[model samples]
Target: MVLQDLGRRINAAVNDMTRSNNLDEKAFDDMIKEICAALLSADVNVRLVGTLRKSIKASVNFASLPAAVNKKRLIQKTVFDELVKLVDPHADSFRPKKGRSNVIMFVGLQGAGKTTTCTKLARHYQTRGFKTALVCADTFRAGAFDQLKQNATKAKIPYYGSLTQTDPAVVAAEGVAKFKKERFDIIIVDTSGRHRQEEELFTEMTQIQTAVTPDQTILVLDSTIGQSAEAQSSAFKATADFGAIIITKTDGHAAGGGAISAVAATNTPIIFLGTGEHMMDLERFEPRAFVQKLLGMGDVAGLVEHVQAITKDSAGAKETYKHIAEGIYTLRDFRENITSIMKMGPLSKLSGMIPGLSNMTQGLDDEDGSLKLRRMIYIFDSMTAAELDGDGKNFVEQPSRMVRIAHGSGTTVREVEDVLSQHRMMAGMAKRVGGQKKQMQRAQNMMKGGNKDQMAAMQKRMASMGGAGGMGGMGGMPGMPDMAKMMQMMGGGQGGGGMPNLGGMDLQSMMSQMSGLMGGMGGGGGGGGGGRGRGGR
Candidate 1:
């Protein structure tokens, strides 16, 4: 089973045991058995799975539990904690300080996506305000330099590689020295990989390591290797002594669990997970966040980080916040939000970071979701200035305007209508909650202050708004079955809410609104083969 399926299976087992009338030791044992089976089927090591089984059973001692204790909550928390232990190496990875050179070297077997991951990691740091560059030292493979050059160029990262230098160690030293002289914060050297752990490969790896003396060495392990990851990681550890691992191709493999668990067993920290081929798909791996997102509980912290990263300087978002505070949500505001969401990353990946939207976007892939979003943009682009600036009432008063937009945007009138309907829903929501400007400002101030208690209070306030006008009306929107319930699940109702209150709205609310809007525009449908309509522009 794939990681998603594995999570679902384990979640189902826990839910089954908790919901059982007998909730006795027998049910608890059965749940443990099912969870172990799921992990084993996902290619987790037998010994590790056995240990996890015992850990869960020990943690949730049904026979010794007090009668007043919440058995169901205890069992669920134990399962989550044990699963987290399976992936948490409990070792801190090397953190690069700003204003200095932190050389990072990549090592792995051939076809483990070492080169691509190099570019991805470089871009990740670059986007985070680090002066990052790439050094391609893989002289063994043909066109390796060209591949690195292409990826680096696309990501706009400075790269150094040689067309004539055949010695990988010489190339690595030259590149690292050049970048260090220029004071690059993070310099990633991509080395060549072999078909197997041969002596020649080991010699070359050690030579390159000695040359650059990278502060951190990362082994880019292929997740499809399954339980063999243990042996591969051990072999690489013996030779290159990599401090961290980056598991690639996890988005397509079922054995990701095995690879993660195996790597953790070796005590090597997993820094990031390559969730997809996109440059933005490199997710910073945190054990608890990973496990939470895996089990469909949502990664609210990750979602907040993504939102903050993408919208930190967004004047459009600021303007929209102001408009919402004044009870206004124009088509232009919606367009800006759609643009921001596009930049945040793939819709499917973002959906998983949300608690309830993942189930709504179940069958939708990145390509299809992106196409739907692009079409929405196309519709906005084809609109008149007045239509976009004002509320969507003009389209309703003049039905012919919808037809005109449909023809201009290369979409159907129904799609245009759906977009207007979504706008109306959001406009209504803004109108209803416009009176909470003081509360919203207080929440925003608390967020900026970064005080734990103040943030918690803000979360409690947002959670309290779940049943109120804040999110109650959103349930009628498409793809949003129950906004209040979803918010509650996100800990909004609980004192330990995870959702971040940005401006006046939370990330979950924004994403759910986007999902609902996209769903109305047929987001779940297949992609259009031809180019999007730009005719009337």
Candidate 2:
């Protein structure tokens, strides 16, 4: 809920405008005021807020737009486009290349979570196949080396630090040389911080930068500091040629907007955000998506990307995807899927990735939704080995067993029944899409091992799975082409005919065409044909 208030205010203003028959100048001005108020309330710098308003207003040209264009939509587009710029500041960021020893230095004040953010950045690259190493150069702070060592050991990442090396500059230079010699892909140097900015500390930071000659210098800012972020960001920006910024503790800070806009004002791009204590809780910062999430317009692409990343890396993930795609799911499968979803992040965060679901799932991170998930997990935990055996069909026959499970999980029998009901729904879906294993397998393969366009990849999966054939002889299998009709058409109802070779066809579009054709045929030929017609769409 970092910018929840701002999001709600902006969303309400947009919704109100959307409902209007026509948008006059007054309505537009009022919308701007609401936006400005939201940003101001979130402690955004007044100057930038004014610039944002001006940009939005300047972008709107009623006279230039054609008669067919929606005035309201144009205004909305202007708002979105300007908001993207407001946080972005068009700053260039350093992109770490693979198979190279890229040195990154983290600098921040004490209590800004700089040390933890260093590990988080290390973990980020490490998970993506980089040989990442951590260097503890915080010789100024007490136990800095120990803290970094603990974090490094926990992540299983190698580290270079010493208890005896009191000079940070010496430690940093030696650590960089050591990592470079070993040919580590990414070497992150964790520097010391002061409680408050001083000439001594700033001078130390400059000396460390000189010694290391880091490829990128990142300034870390704690988001909870509110409006003081401007001065804090300015202080760091002045000291080091900050290539990027990492705002820590953004998961629950109401002043996240202030810190973000403040740092962005320095023309330094935020590369990532520390959402939680876990290293994996770090999220790559995207300006448009950030504003979209703030406005209650969910980031669907981000959601899908997260899903693919988690499921692909997870154990038995490929199998899970295959089962779900083939509709061979079960209660056990459902439980596994639930576990995977939880691994992706909180349900509330996931919900924001889906369009139109953000508002409905607003309070999902609170007690209500979290409690529901915990209860379900507990219920699953309490199930006996025999009861959870093989697709969990045993639970279907015994109603009394649900009562026992509810008692064990410290919940109601009604909740247990709800879980069972969910299982049944999944089972029914599995049965509905049976026998498309080949297509599903192809879809699963298409989704793995890439950082390409997520929606495009999904479309390719659907299109590839819905490969050649119309709707016939495949029953209700999802994306299954009608081999019989395909061969029939290819041969033109003659002998020596077989399924057509529609090689390299975009099956997603073809499926749509086939659905329309089948619908127009209107249950012709046979009952199976009618079933195909019904399912093709």
Candidate 3:
């Protein structure tokens, strides 16, 4: 995520300039140099970096700007625009239309993760209601077919391949024809790739492409190749008609800017980025939003879209929202929440979509952290109906309750306590969020092609959620602050409105303090709270 780090640095540099009384060419040049260094370090092509620097300098005419104009804002805007232009080719690429046979052929080097990407692509389409199937024409790699079959089976996607077939063209043709005969609308053919761009591999790829006449040929590029990505993409483009690029292993520590800019150099559009190893890790590339997320500006639109992809019916969504809005979430409700979030994909990814949480979650690259949520589900499921559904005070006030629940759930007492602690914190915040539902509703209504007022309302509501400070949309979120009357309501700052500093509490410590919950959970009587957002609807 070096490119992401670059966005953060660029944002910070711009802010530094704004803080100073003197805004001159010297300051501007310094920022540009920093950007150049960052891009170059991220393996961006030197020529492209030079061009971007020139373009930014030409647009940001700080010397001639009117005194009344905001210097910092203009410069930031120019930087964002220039960076986007550098990466976006704006090339027209194929999109699968419903009710038709759309064939996609994947091409790449042997280790570029081509086969896995084919399954991922097939799963993406399959989830979208496409009649999708996978065809493995990769006969060069040992166990290529077996690898594809394993991935396809896990994703529950139908696949076609042959152990006996030596000719990739025949295998591809047979698979496509078989899926087509079954009236499958989306057929993805994964072709052979070599250790290098050798003639034999190119010949095999060309034969398969000619036989199938693919509707779109997607070239999967490994982002870790850094500076060489451009040359690699260019070389491949010369051999096959690549309609789009898919950058894989983007979740790694590789400098990815080179891969992105290099592919764009060939006028090829990057349609998706493989964020992780899972089938659902592939994300449709959105340049501006990607940059925004990288800069820690929350992509609420993207977040909403991810949620929608996994959520099934309206009732299931609404019921969860009800619990969140009421500040009365039970253990049962908590389990459902965890289940729903798991469906949205990786926790680190989901967390990064939130405003302030990105910086915090950027370090959580391990899959083990995500398992914590699953553990919460198991621990909570052990509780009795009275224990699960009740306000959390019983567990907090009665130590024996924790013991009994731990025994019932087959978990350690410490784990049970941790689950209760998280529950209490969630329940408390739900009340606060529930109160702001009206303001959030107003903002959403205004957000339909609306202006700053929508963002203003959202900012205000977000502050009230007990997040550390104001967001920069001005700065998690937790998904904001107007204090005066609300703070006074909780008995002179100690009221349920003014809950304890649950933010910094340790997992172990928070578990034992569950009685502090608002509404019915804690010793403090919980007040009423409610809301109606997209999830609420």
Candidate 4:
């Protein structure tokens, strides 16, 4: 089973026990048993599973608990904390300082995706204002330098490699010297990997380590190796004395739980996870956030970070915020929001960051989700300038206009109607919250001024609105609503007659209807037919 299935099984077990009428010791034991079984099926080490079971049982002794305590909350917290402990090694990874060349070397078995990960990490740092570069030192593998060159060129990051230098160590030293002389912030050296733990590979790793003297040696382990990750990580640790780990291929059909648990047993910190093949797929691994996402609890903090990172220079976003503050959300504003979300990354990945969205889009993959978002854009593109800037009420007055748009955009009349409906809901939300412009400006100023107390108070209010204790605080960008107000609208609160009601729609229907309104939009019907429409356009 994949991680999602494992999470669902564990969640179901916990919910079952908590909702039981008895809520006795037997139900608790049964819940534990079900969770252990799920973990074992996910290829977690047998000994580690046993230890986790014991730790959870010891922490939640039903007999010792007082009758007045909230048993349900206690049990839920115990489960979340234990799962986090299972993956966290309680060790800090190396932190690179700016204005200095921080050399980071990569080591792993063959087919572990070291070359690709190097470019991904380089681009990740580069986007965050770090002058990063890549050094390809894999002389053993044919065309390794060429692969790195291709990836580096695509990412537009400077790279160093040689066609004549057969010695990996020499190439590594040269690359590091050149980049350090240029004063690069982060320099990543990609070394070759072998089929197994051979003596030649070990000696070569040592040579590269001695040549570059990297501040941090990261071991890239493939998740498909399952429980064997423990042995592989141990061998590399002894030979290269690496300081950190990065697990690749977690997005594949691999039973990643085993590899994660196995690596954690070795007391090494996992710094990042390669979630997909895209350059933007590397996710910073935080133990608590990882467990929360795995259990379908959502990671609002990650979502906020993603948004802030991608929207720092987005003028359209700034404009939309201003319009919303003025109680105005035109069709043009809706189009800009959809376009911005498309640039943020894959829709499938972003959906998981919201509390109930992942479940709603569970059946849609990345490709389908992207297509849905593009079709929404095509609909906006087909509209005339006047219609695009209008409030969408004209379409309601003349229903024939919907047919013309559907034909022009290659979408159906129903899809066009859906878009208009979503726009109306968003317009209503903006109008209702326009009165809080002063409050939003105060929150935005607090965030910009780095007022921790005010920010904390705002985050607390937002968390209460979400009913999720640890939702991350929004930065309250210019013209944007305060975090609390945004969460209130999302959670469908009743403060000043919250967001327009959806006619008592179920969770799935509500999510589908509000897809374009929420930042977590995408994933719905119109895949097969929408492709033709896009092609024609």
Highest TM-score: which candidate?
Answer: 1
State which candidate has the highest lDDT.
1
Judge candidate 4 against the unseen true structure and give its global Cα lDDT, from 0 to 1. Answer: 0.77
C-alpha lDDT values of all predictions? 0.79, 0.69, 0.70, 0.77
Quote model 2's TM-score: 0.78
lDDT (tens digit, per residue) of candidate 4 on 1-537: 248778889999999998999888899999999999999888888888999999999999877898899988999999999999998989888998898999999999999999999999998888778899999999999999999999999999999999998999999999999999999999999999864448987899899999999999999988788777777788888898888899898777767776787556679889988888888778888889988888887776666555545554567766665676577878988887677567757656777766767776676666766776677787787788889889999998998888777776776677778788887877776675555545655766787888888787876675565564332333322222445454344433542123222111112232443364333333333433443342222
Candidate 1 residue lDDT tens string, 214-310: 9999999888888787888888888888899998887784657668765666798888888888887788889999899889998877776666556
What is the TM-score (0 to 1) of candidate 1?
0.84
| RMSD after Cα superposition, model 3 | 10.8
Clashing pairs in 4: none
lDDT of 1: 0.79
Clashing pairs in 2: 470-482, 487-498
How do the predictions measure up, each by TM-score? Answer: 0.84, 0.78, 0.75, 0.83
Query: Which ranges in model 3 have alpha carbons more than 4 Å from their true place?
Result: 195-197, 313-328, 342-347, 362-375, 391-400, 406-537
Ranking by lDDT: 1, 4, 3, 2
Worst 10 residues of 2 by lDDT: 528-537
User: What is the Å distance of residue 97 in model 2 from its true position?
Assistant: 2.5
